[model samples]
Target: MELENVIDAAVEEVLGLAQGWLGWDGRPVVFDGNAWTPHKSLRRVTDHLVDHLAEIMCRLNGLDPLPDHWHGRTVTTHADFARFTETDLEEATSRLTRLALMYRAGLRGLDPAVLDARPDPDTWTLREVVEHVAGVVYYARAMS
Candidate 1:
């Protein structure tokens, strides 16, 4: 899928999860007996998309991923999910779009061979995951 499509899907999916299956607090889908935390839940959702973007960059370079830690986990506390308003959502979306645009630009400007070159093993590269959740939304104004 195209980058815009991927981003849109991520946003829609997150909103749906937040409004429906997952509460504002990021509770686990399983309510019967699960430890749900709101902050962590939000982080989980955010990290999912970030990881996808990272994977895309990694695949372009033909590198194996480091073992991931949160492959499977259960919700446990309010700190996991936290709380945010609709405005926060809008801002975040905007920031992501902006960052995505920049990424696109950088991708376009790269040499064909260098685009896929791997960075030094111990050095961080552009594809390294960033924890700035609202980056694109904040600077790019892509959020709606």
Candidate 2:
């Protein structure tokens, strides 16, 4: 799929999820025998999406992906993953919306050649990852 289509799909899906899950009080939205509390602030999830989009943006500009190891770490415990404050939610939504708009603009201005070019041999090209995120966003919704 085109990068723009992928990005648009992801944004729509995430916004829809956010609308539905806005009332969530950080309970375990999923627990299929495995002990994991998947529920989190919409802020957390929005922040994550923005971070990954930034990674894509950097990769598109021929830069290395920065290690945001903090995001990769697990929550301290079930209790620690509680609901976010109204302020936190507001900030996250603002940042995420800005990031999403930037992604859309970037997609509009990107050259086809740039999208086709591979950034690394072992990794996916920038375009591939953009589409991959669209797929992953769906998975994120299901698992959330």
Candidate 3:
């Protein structure tokens, strides 16, 4: 399957689970050794997409990707404790769907050869990055 389709499918899975958060009871669920709330799961998924999207754009532009300082799965902020409202669900759907579309368009526009090019020895190829982002579906699934 095309990498963009794979990413969109994964994001769609998350979006489906996010709707369930509107009924969340504000209890913390532990998954993969980290505490998860509905908000935290959504935040992590969004952040992961944005972070890697930036990395892909930066590398394509010949600029270094900025470092991400997200504590990711290690600590939950006060905002993460907020109630998951219908408005929040709408916002998540809007935000994540737009990001998914951006990823799809951006990745589809790249030449197939570009997917195999690495920006640095330590960095992953663009193809691998998309796969990693697809793996983030686990975060939303954990909330389910």
Candidate 4:
């Protein structure tokens, strides 16, 4: 399958599961030795997509990627503890869907050679990066 198709499918699945959290109680669920709430899962998935997107863009432009200081799955803010409502679900759907589409557009714009070329020996190729983002299904899957 194409990388973009895989990413789109993963994001769609995440959002579908997130829709199930519309009336979630204000309790954190433990998963893989970490706590996960609806907000936290959404935030993490969004952040992961954005972070790697930035990295891909910067590498394509021959620039150093900015450091990401995201707290990730470790810190759950007060807002993360909020009740998951229909409004939040709508916002997540909008934000994540757009981001996933952006990834598709960006990947489509790149040359196939560039997709396979690593920015550095230690860095992942753009294709690998997209696959990594697709793996973020685990976040939403855990919450579901």
Candidate 5:
């Protein structure tokens, strides 16, 4: 389907899995040889969403996309190993839901041709970028 529906579904799916992580034992699960704790997973998911959302906005506004300096997922921080709390879940839900809604509002109507067109020769089409962002659902599921 469209970017809005795809991203909304992925966000809800991630949140649903996150709801069950209150009992995590401060252990990380490995995926593709990368360690993922609850905090790390949540961080990756949100950061990925925000990064691409900002990229899309910048492109739409005809401005260059500013760099989002991320940790690049290679090093896990001390914060990533902290115990996950109920408040963490609530905050994640709020942030992700709001982001998904913003996607909906921002992309509600657009020319089909424009969505399929690359913002530049070096970049993916906007639709492809949105699909990649939706893949953040992998983070929550990795803990399961």
Candidate 6:
């Protein structure tokens, strides 16, 4: 499947599962040794998306990717334990849907040759980067 489709599906699935998180039992779910509350999961997925998008932008601009300060994958913040509400769900949906669209449009604008090329042996190709972030479905699934 195309990388864009992979991201779209993941984002959709995450948002779908997130709908039921309003009734969260006020406990974190353990996944890969990380504690995942609804806020933490949403934060992780958004961070992952923005991080990769920054990488793509930096590479295209002949610059290095910005360093990420995200520690959500391991550190559970106090805010992470907050209640999940209908308002939060709506915000998440709007935020993630726009991010997914940006991801898709960004990838689609790149030349096919550039998408597959590995300019830096140290990093994954652009397509691979997109595919990697598509795995964000795991974050949302932890809420189930």
Best model per TM-score:
4
Superposed model 4: Cα runs more than 4 Å off: none
lDDT of 2 at 79: 47
Candidate 6, superposed: residue stretches over 4 Å from native: none
lDDT per model, in order? 0.45, 0.59, 0.87, 0.87, 0.86, 0.87
- Tens digit of per-residue lDDT, candidate 1, span 1-144: 433343454454455443432224433334324444433444554555456456546655677665566643354544544555576556555654554554454355455455334567764443333223223222111111
| TM-scores for candidates 1 onward, in order | 0.45, 0.68, 0.94, 0.95, 0.93, 0.93
lDDT per residue (tens digit) for residues 3-91 in model 2 = 77666667666655555544556655443333323234343455566667878778867687887764432343554366645554465
> Across residues 23-122, which tens digit of lDDT does each residue of candidate 3 receive?
7888889888888998899999999999999988888888888998888878888899899999998899899889999898888778878999876798
lDDT (tens digit, per residue) of candidate 4 on 39-91: 99999999999999899878878899998898888887888889888999999
Candidate 2 error regions (>4 Å): 31-44, 68-80, 84-92
By TM-score, is 1 or 4 better? Answer: 4
Put down candidate 5 lDDT per residue, 1-144, tens digits, no spaces: 766688899999999999889978998999867898889989889898889889888888888998778885676899999999999999999999999998887678967787799755888988888888899988888788
Alpha-carbon lDDT of model 4? 0.87
Model 4 worst lDDT window (10 residues): 103-112
